[model samples]
Target: MYKFKILIEGYARTGANGVYFASPTSSLIYDEKVKVLVDPGTNADALRSSFEREEMEFKDIDIVFLTHYHPDHFLNIRLFPNVDLYDGTTRWHGDQEHFYEGRLPGTDIELVPTPGHTMEQTSLVIETVEYGIVFVCQDVFWWEDGKQKSDNVNDLLNNPDPFMASWKDLQNSRKIVLDRADWIVPGHGKMFRNPRRN
Candidate 1:
């Protein structure tokens, strides 16, 4: 079985012009066979420090998984140098490079589409002894009890961020994740037990 850790808890904020700036939550998934980094967000300094906190270094990372093509989520990705990456989209990069999908070749981890914040986004589903089922879902759900919105039980049902690619798609994706995830490491917040479930 695999285990995971939140390398960097993510956050997002809105400036003028509906300009959304985000810090993608980066997580580490490591098992006997592989070491993976999901959404290696934009801040290289922060990422380096997070690695230090875990007593790890850059080269230790094996696979880099991009949930979507957003810059903030992928900017620091090249730091790993020649490691394999799952570009998180079906179409060849708009440049013809293939994107990997389904259960990863050597692991029990599976990629499930959880779009809406962006049409091509995907979430990570892995079974772990410590957390049961963990969903590293990026952006489909914001912080618990609201992201930009005020914090409250309303956050449980108020929907994800104010900005999204499609509301209808997001709602459908959220239902699947919130229903199945034992715990979720959201795109822009600390990991939380599924509030609706508990």
Candidate 2:
């Protein structure tokens, strides 16, 4: 079985027109085989503190899973310069690149292509004995309050605050994730039970 821990619970504040800054939630997933860090958010200090508290070093992490190409979500990847990065579609390790379609090689984790916040946005899914099915979905679902209304994707797409790449894609992505996730670690908040699931 796999296990996960939230390294950083992220947050954001929105200002005027189209102006918002956020730090994506960072998560750690591990089993007997591998240790993966998801979305190493912009909170470098918090990340360092978490590592120190856990008595961990940079090398302990094997892969940095970037849910999307956004900077806020991936900024702290610099902390793990030597680790491999799975950027939704390709895994980058030093001078080598390995491309994967669905499941990442050598792991039970499933990579779902959940676009819209950005075109290449993706969510990492894994089933664990403790958490059941977990989806570390970045940006696809972001809210100021962790329990933002999700019963209607149309309402989400209609919200003027968020910048979306495609309404249709985000709508579908939200539905797909909500349908399957027992719990979700969203882009800029703590993990919560999937409202649609409960």
The parts of candidate 1 lying over 4 Å away from their true place are 14-21, 89-100, 143-154
Residue 35, candidate 1: alpha-carbon lDDT: 90
**Candidate 2 Cα outliers beyond 4 Å, as residue runs:** 14-21, 145-147, 150-161
Model 1: per-residue Cα lDDT at residue 80: 72
Error of 2 at 154 (Å): 7.4
**Per-residue lDDT of model 1, residues 77-146, tens digit only:** 6797666677554423334666457875566788899888889888989998898899988788775324
Q: Which clashing pairs does model 2 show?
A: none
Tens digit of per-residue lDDT, candidate 2, span 54-173: 788878988888888878988888778777788878989788988988886778889999987899998989998888999988788787754455555465445433577987888788
The TM-score of predicted model 1 comes to: 0.84
